[model samples]
Target: MTLSIDNLQQMEIEYIKMFSEVSEDEQTLTFNNSNIPDMYTHNFDLYKSDVGLLEYIESQINKVETKAKGFFRIETYHPISADLIEKLSVKPQICTYDFMGIETRNYINLIGNPECSVLSAESSRVLEDGITVDIAVNEEGMGLDFATRRIKGKAEVYKNPDKAIELFVCYSGDTPIGNIEYIPFNRVAKFEDFDILEDYQRRSFGTSVLKHLLEKAFDNNIEHAYLITDQADTAKEMYKKNGFEKVGEKTELLFLF
Candidate 1:
């Protein structure tokens, strides 16, 4: 099939929907928990006028009062006016992600590396000598709070029994330094949460893990291989080197109280 903008947008929608534990609609997604700072997800493309944006922003504030309690966030596919920030009385949090999909031509053939081996193991699978593959949510222990990193908290997915996610952790010499997630939806294998420890980076471990996943993609008959990354220079560079490009982008806004 063709990799269209619509396809990329849908992937992002589904990715965020996985966290909708309270309510979800065409325009907004509200998480029920207050401790989770990113309790609201603004999914509409309604940046036509300042009035429309203000109305939408107010609704989100009202929803926060009705839904979750703690600090909240609004993520939009369209850009809003700076005036909206003053009206809503919320701080502006800017973030960008490159929706990258692997092209057909780039998949010349399935290749594996000798250093980093891929294993279909559990997240807790320990490595005695080398890094073993495992799974987990790629969140920093500080929860979803955007202001401070001092509070070490985890996402609810870690404790939710309904969550169906498999985290891939790569270890190098008995140390867990690299990680990724395999989200298979609609017969498409989406690789996300790709990260490597700072000390272990630039050592070909990331490339090897990516290639290992690609090698598995061949046998799975996956319709697509893709991932979304933030503005991390090192990770972005690695993805571009391995044949990934920015297909689309979305705007994310965070509010703290």
Candidate 2:
């Protein structure tokens, strides 16, 4: 069965609902998780690109900002106009994510490196270590550090059994160097938080981890696997080479206060 953009969006909404308090109306969907105050969980998704709605969104988010110290994010399926963007009180950073998907059957025979292996992690501790190392390296180059809160929030989400999420840690000869999160719903799998430590990159460990996950999905009769990656990220190239294709795009406007 070919999954359409609508199917992918619905799947994302369902996944978000697993760990958030979700409320929706005609214009927008709001997700709130006070425990996990991360951008992914505490944000508003605008259904329409109407500039008129900005005032209300700003007011609502202002209330959230007063209570917590994190980003105020707005996501839209339709691109917001430049004029609408300029109306914001603070300069916002915009990002676009490619929604990529692939049929798991196509990669059933794909082979990964013999030295690298992926395993389901019962504890989030290993995954947290990998994420901290990755963030330290990336921040050194980018000159920004916000990993503490982000990592803590992710670890909290990973512990939620109700989400039915599996955390996979990639190991190279007993040394953990990477991790990924898998969520299965209705025979479809959503892959997230895929990361490879900076020192271990450029090797084939990333490909190995991906192939291991794809193979596992195929073995379980999963029809398709999808993931969201930043459009500017080079990792999307690797994903394309492994059979995933861009099915859609998610646009977001973010303000960090």
Worst 10 residues of 2 by lDDT: 137-146
lDDT of each: 0.55, 0.74
lDDT of 1 by residue, 138-165 (tens): 2344243331211122223433446544
List where candidate 1 sits over 4 angstroms from the true fold. Answer: 17-19, 32-51, 62-68, 81-88, 104-113, 126-164
TM-score (C-alpha) between model 2 and the true structure = 0.82
Which is the leading candidate under TM-score?
2
- Tell how far residue 109 is off in model 2, in angstroms: 5.2
| Residue 86 accuracy (lDDT) in model 1 | 72
Q: For residue 197, what is the lDDT in candidate 2? A: 81
